[model samples]
Target chain A: MATADSTSPCTEYIHIAYPVSPIDRVTWVDLPDALWHEILRFSAVQDLVRMERVCKKFNIQLDRKDRSHGAQEQGREREREREREQEQLSSIHDLWKTHCQHRWNDKPRYKLTDEREDWLRRHYDEHFATVDYGDTAGGATGRATGRATGSRTESSHVMMGNAAPFPVANTASSSPSTTSTPSLSKFSWKKTYFWMEQELARTTLTYDELESLDWYFNFTPLAGGRGKDTLLRCIFRHGLLSIGGAGFPSLPYRMLFLHPGDNPDIFSEQQVNATDQHSDTDTTTDATTDTETHDNPIFHGGIDTSQARRHNQEQAVLIADFPLHYVSRLHDSGEWLMTNAHVTFVSTDEAGALTYKDRNFQ
Target chain B: MADEGNGIIRLRSSDGKVFELTESAAEISELLKDSPREEDDEVTEIDIVRVASPCLEKVVEFMKHYDEEKMKEIPTPLGGSTFNEVMDQPWYQDFVSDEKMNRDMLFNMLSAANFLGIKPLLDLTCLKVTFQITGKNAEEIRELLRLPELTPEEEAKAREEHSWIFEEA
Candidate 1:
């Protein structure tokens, strides 16, 4: 808090006449080039990219000779003479290869023979371009139907459907890029690092991101439904379903679901019919209106207009008022196990806190 | 002075303040280990002209508590968001936390650590700096470091050249 010109209050009585020397107060800019390099060594790749924008000093420090020194002929000549031997030993390709290995150490190493490809950028694009959230229908439909059903069985289906295609689709998309590269020479590892960070921020939901959403579903169980559902609330965004309620653990449990494809009609006919019988005409019309607004293709199949009308009416009514006639049968039926969804549980620790656990999901 | 025969080394700061430490503790700094010793009264005294009293005091305190076995290795590309999560020792976390160390003092401590060739302190200070720089944009980083604003032309050119970084995901 003390400024360079302000003398310490403790030192005022001892040295009232003499002011503190300005040379003693050092700023970040005053640090020597050697110390700057030491600090740069500790920075991550994304930090290095942003540091270039901080000031010209950092920009010049982080700039590569090939990219930044086009007009400086004299400096380039000197640099060439100084780095002739070093450049031969460690090429730009080797430098980026080391970066790729360090950042994605867990990824399987590939023996690449192509010299023209920018392996680091390719690796980033392949791994992060599309974050698999399971099949599309599984995410969107599961959310809509789960809100309507409000049963533990439906919640399990939502998890299973959302988790099914994530790991499999991710691996499927990433493998082909390693072999196919025609325009990778234009990319740089530093840019790729920024892109990866951006993609990560987009896919992963922070506590703040969750709290900002206006719509959330609280599915309290109807009579005869097992367990107390008073505290359970679910928020779905970017194909991620976050479950948090009162008395739940401090960690917010999140499930990632990817593709939003066909709606498989996971709802049982008997449950749909029973709920439809209890719904009044006004609520049925409102449910139809809600379905029309979403315009989702998943709900269009396997139901006649009357059955669909009744189902929509039941869906419009809150889950608390709906009948739980099919709860026992759905629990014993094991119907949620239809998909091969590999559900990975992602839990955020505390508010605005990001840990290695979230990064692993990326 | 009783520990003069026990290999106690005396370090003199630029502002005429002297701090004493055992030779084992002093060995944490390569500069201290390699400094030419004075044989006055069978005690060693080395002058460090670059480090002032306040920075040297911190350096000496860190060296006194230096333990090779207990020191945790700081991870590269920092895996955790906060320094407390990354650093296992609470004492080490408190050493560089904002409550105890200000920006100027932290930079000065870094300079002193660098000048004295203390690798662990250097790494710890740099890690603290890296934590500050992480997850912050360029303007925020400039504000944190108290750097002056760039000229209008330079700012536009820099942004134009690195437009990808400025774009939202």
Candidate 2:
């Protein structure tokens, strides 16, 4: 608990000046107004906000750029992020498509045949609806259901015994014979929801040995205050998990996944070769070892550049004694928040029994 | 009407002196634009001897160049443009040369930045002043700004409010 690494640099800034030089040193109107104008134009709005506070002069309380500015700035950013995610999904689709249809190609495509097109689109719509930034249905792009409606079809295929010929959606459009098999019509439309649920279910982090990561920050989930404060404090006694974009306009996104008690440090497990890595081969891990085995959810895909919006890695995340939600809102303006998507927080259900209050030094 | 930029506007300094300039020159004060339209008439200047007439002249010069997009070439607080070269403008040198004149002007400029709510200009100007005032003791601060030396009681009040900085002697 009392490690040298745990305690070191402490930087806190406080500003106070008396009547003679209320802001101390100099004032702005004194500077040629031209100099002031130039300074305002170049900086990002966020940085300007902070620079403003340093002195009464700089505190230009710019009304947050009007709606148009926010749309132009933040909206455009959202669009770019969406595009990047789509591109990655498309690549993943290609692999699934090729391997299922024509293993011949080096890479496969997730062929959105006519039959599954609508279903797939619906699925996409539904999936995104429930995820982070929720509920507002996007403009229905005609391409949604028109693509892979076939594979995700509501109809069933005839299965001959255990080989339960799954209605693979990636049937090649080029393979004409593969289409219209009467055999496909003979079966029952079994709702694939069970399998689908299994596929889409997200495993909560720290299900196992991941508990050691508690040192990262006070990850307890609690809403700090009901009023002005809107900050989710990430407390840590020692280890620093620098979480988001840096300096002033920083937005943190990268998540540090943890689980409850598999060997949180699996890399040290000598008997087993890397079990949680690329190979899907099963290993016999006892309950204790299982805890150790899946300790940390290593981004097997590595640091995703596509996900590094706002320079995600630059943020510093620490463990506070409580959950981030417990900290008062840093900007809780009655806006509905979606976990990880809108400022950080977890509802009481997600992070049981945490007490945090909203407090601000300012 | 199109000559709104060239329209006439009047600015009265804190000590009841009025100077009429084109609307554009007056707009340089941002306080007008940012203030509630209804309150515009109330901003009639009181005295700001801290901003000397010579400094006002320089401010006008700055506004003239600034209106023509000159400020855009200068860096701002947002995008990290440290165009320090702009500070080297000859007049900037002369403005600071007569410390007494610039000192008063600097205070005015700071007040103007505050009134206008323009962060960058305020930051740059204030930062310049900080360098001028940094490390200087209270007596020097009062003398440099021409404020009369504070009476013991007044000095104590000021210190009490801002005890964050302490004299170790």
Candidate 3:
């Protein structure tokens, strides 16, 4: 065997060829569009689906296509989303229809104070003459502005109360003359708040509203007052209506305190925790009550009421005994001034001393 | 009114290109016979305005050869006799793939094959079209096709409008 690189004669000449293959180079465009479309129809469904999404040309062919299998969960999710949207739309419609239905009845009505009486009459009296066909005849003296006129079909009795500065619902004005415009449109918050305070003070006892208070609200009937449950009722807070009614006014339903802005929790957890410390009943001052219990016949027999109380007093001493020893040991070690000792840092001095400082309770 | 001979059709291209062929040759095109047509003295119209004069001459060349090959390639059990024979040859393939025959000649050949209902010629020419067009970028294609440039304002607006396309790219 001779190698081309080693022998000059063997490497003298060489021949190479690069033949072309025409049949090997073909693509979708090789076929007529109609035949290509038929081939597309016959393709394994996966390639057909991917091709349809790949370009606008394939998209055109996919216009009338239908799929027999797709993600079933995705279909269900879409249907559920559609249903949720429909429900929200219906709820909004119902809320709006409720407002519309109550148009004339319980319509947001207003009345005027002495300062405002003139302007309301001037703007509204002439147009409202035709509104209440009966006002012309019944001589009711007050006309409602946005309040209910004829809405009476629904089940709930829409009291038609004014949204703010609740008014006297009197409707009687037969005159056609225009009243002069008044100066002030806005009412003073102080005036309204004072008027509310005055109205609430008139109530001697408030108990019925207390019935509405949830457990979180401090509710107690005003002591030593007599009347209908509604009349003799006062809560220690206002704005109770928010639990089930109108806007939240800071003062609760009917608050009673020795002073204004006083804690509604006057007898609540704050008082209980503060006074509970004095309730140990095991203090040395009550030691005789504990010692005398053992000599009493009822304390041993557990039959007499006084003896039962004596026994309880002794039991309190027994329970409080252990926690106090640590207090006593701590005191002996360094004068136990702290019964509720909170230990922060434990350090001993070089002078052979154990130092305990009262930790200001955080 | 119904008197007729063995089926055959006469095709006339837009450039006064006349082709006479049997019914089967014309019928290979699904559209040729299915038309609810009323026969008239006038020759039928087939649009071939794009078939440039020189390429149309090549198109006629390819169709003449393709029809002859197709006749020999197909078989039928006619009159209780069957004949199956195939000639091993490179003449047909070489005629189609000759690089000296320009792209226009190939395009015209493909169009004429569709019109005259010749299948193999259509396949060969269409494949050449695909090879020429595929894998070309927009700029390269625009240059090859001699399209004009986008205005400066249009370029800016298109950048904004198709920003997402660039984002994916």
- lDDT against the true structure, each candidate: 0.46, 0.31, 0.30
Q: Write the per-residue lDDT of candidate 2 for residues A1-362, one digit (tens) a residue.
A: 00011123222211111122222345333333345444333332222222222322321111112222444456767657545434433433332233223211111112224554333333332221222110000001111223211122111111111111112332223343533432221111111221222121212221121212221121112223223233333322123334322342323332243323433222222122243254454432222223223222231111111211111111112233211111111111111111210123322211222232211111
Docking category for candidate 1? incorrect
Top of the candidates by lDDT: 1
> lDDT per residue, candidate 2, B1-169, as tens digits?
3244555444444333455555565565554333222122422232222344444454555555555543332332223223234455554444444453456566666565554444444655655554454344444544554544445644454344223222311
Q: Write the per-residue lDDT of candidate 3 for residues B1-169, one digit (tens) a residue.
A: 1123224444434344555544444445544444222244233333233333455455555544554665233211111111111222355545655555654455446555564455655555544443343334334434433334555644444334233222222
- Note each model's CA RMSD in angstroms: 16.1, 27.5, 35.6
True contacts kept of each: 0.35, 0.06, 0.00
State the lDDT of candidate 3 residue by residue for A98-148, as single tens digits: 222222122112222442233233433222222222221111111112222
User: TM-score of model 2's chain A, to 2 decimals?
Assistant: 0.18
Error of 3 at A209 (Å): 59
Per-residue error at A357 for model 3, in Å?
79
Clashes of 1: 12
DockQ for each model: 0.18, 0.05, 0.01
What lDDT would candidate 1 get against the real structure? 0.46
The model with the greatest DockQ is 1
